[model samples]
Target: MEMLCEIHPLHEWRGLLSQLVKMAFSIFSIIGTLPIVIVFGLYFIITINSYLKTKNLSTIFFSLSFLATTLTYTVWGLRVFLLPQYDPHISNLLPYWTSAYLFASLSLIFLDFACIELSGIENKRIKQIIYSIILITYSILVAILFIGFEVEITTFMDVSDLSISNIFVYAYFILLLLFYLTLPNIVFINYIRTSILKTSLTYKKVRTIEMGLSLFTIGTILDGARFPSNIGILIARILIMIGGLIMLIGFTFKPRAKED
Candidate 1:
């Protein structure tokens, strides 16, 4: 797929007024992503503390996954913020974006494992296998791609929007993406779906989390698919921020035991 590279470089703003406008957007975009970072950051802290108290392995995975997610947002900000000096250079942005992708993919792997445990299946071995496969496959694909493309300056601003020259590589890459994305989501959906039977708090928690995921997914698609307007990006960022807050609400919502 050809990447739409209409990057609105902040350096184009020459006058003081234009520079101030540019700063406004940059600050907003960065701030928009900050809520997600905080959400996941708190999640990481809570899970690590839970793991320490209970010694449950799944909480460790949850901690790792949330931490990875926090890293993803941090790295993702590199391209999204239209800072005057932070133009999306292939050399500079590529590494940050790729590492962000790795972190995201790794997060999904851990998320899947945590979901499995929370869902009461405990197929840890299978989750480990999936994790290893995705890690290795992505590593190999990225290496082969960089070797082939050589970081040439293309029209695309985002690395993910780069058009693949090789048919086989593209196909493999697509499959790799699905592999990274699909299973974890499936596992998580099932986990959440099954979680609400016990208590009203659980139900509220699951519903809130579901809404968060919905908002986040829509926001990502709107932004990632290149909606062709500045307003679209701004709106997407706002939606994602709301989603992050909702996710935090759900994370902190726990079911209480039935009263005697």
Candidate 2:
């Protein structure tokens, strides 16, 4: 006996839409990171030249941060293209973890820059302590993820699948939501309230960075949505890329010499 299984029209339409969304996201991801790489590459080169001439440690830090961010986006864009169609293997963990680490590092770098560059925190000891705490906390999370966690890729509503569960994964998202999303907004609001330089162009640049952070935060939240629709994911990716662009623009404006 031959059994013929007839697919429902609604299911077929949904599957087509899902595929289309995934294709769109993948294409955008590929195209979006190209400019980021070029811009950051130039930034890194210029920073290196300036550092060589002046030997400013801050300049070196800024250059390294930009380099890391550029690599993060590049790897992320590549991963979108390389994502497995089926369940991911244990071997796939390395690339996934590497991309995540790079992204998290980028966030930490920006936070450090905000504290030192924008907030004008001057106590070296205090800065060291804060940096150590952040690094150690993230390191622990990464260690746990590397050692104890297992990733499973499962399809939702016949769309492309992703890792949906894991304690360390949840912790990473919570940390990002708190630090990258919430803290930046708080910092910006505090600056607006207390800053004497609010009328200056420098302050406006800081505000632009804040806006970029807000966009990135929203995109992160959208990316984490439990909805089965792949459109949300596509939109989230686009928002993230735009946020990156805005952030880069903000970074281009150096703080006034008198302010520094």
Candidate 3:
């Protein structure tokens, strides 16, 4: 017969601290994400109205992307809030994964359009190729995420024991890291190189975008590193919230057309 280890008082205190940390994090996440959801919801509505008026595909894509992103964060906040009481199951996590996948696809589509239109990429074939590549890459990433989610749900453990031995998990994370690094660099480079005559306004807009992307990248790193410590997780969530808000601010500043 296997004997259970005796629980110590110090261990109990540590556990209590962890629970307190988690509760605080969840509360912060809900509070932060609620405002984001409302703001983005309004943005999505405005984008839809603009698309209907102008018949612009970009506007429609932006609207859908924003809506998906808002939903993703909303689900995330709910998950954080419910995690303590909710029983772990694949079905419980499916909505979060699905919303995240939708957000990824829509965001990629929006980014493709923005790059082509704002960067003044005149080559239609190039634009088509870029769009195709973005779609294919996003599909592969989503597939990896699906597989990773299966592994995670099957082998559910405390965050301290969360390991990334699975190939799908590794692929998903690596691809995401590569995307965060490469896409920002590409966008900034394209903005600088392709603009015929960059003005102060355009430069400021690019700078704002760059800052937002930088914060996002930092938040991603922190989130990935958030294991074995409740404090780390709390910090990661805070950074993510701040990063998202900055990114939203950047999005509001449309890229200015190059002065002729």
Find the candidate with the highest lDDT and give its number. Answer: 1
**In candidate 2, what are the lDDT values of residues 7-49, reduced to their tens digit?**
5666788987776567446544545556666766776677667
Q: Indicate which candidate wins on TM-score.
A: 2
The sequence of per-residue lDDT tens digits that candidate 3 reaches over residues 1-260 is 22324456667889877776674465545554576677667767877787788776655665776676577667666666555423356566666656655574565456446534544466789778777877787777677656554434422113111234577666666676556346654866667766655565555555565565566566556655534455565565566556656655554565547632
> Which pairs of residues clash in candidate 2, taking residues 3 or more apart in a chain or in different chains?
none
Candidate 1: segments with Cα more than 4 A from true spot: 1-28, 78-89, 122-129, 141-174, 188-211, 221-223, 235-251
Poorest 10 consecutive residues of model 3 by lDDT? 154-163
Worst 10 residues of 2 by lDDT: 155-164
| TM-score for candidate 2 | 0.66
List per-prediction Cα lDDT, in the order shown.
0.61, 0.61, 0.58
Task: Give TM per candidate.
Answer: 0.64, 0.66, 0.64
For residues 11-109, what per-residue lDDT tens digits would candidate 1 score against the true structure? 344455565555445554555567778777887888788788888866687689779888988876655643333344566556665676667666656
Which residue runs of candidate 3 sit more than 4 Å off their true CA positions? Answer: 1-29, 80-86, 101-105, 144-150, 153-165, 200-204, 224-260
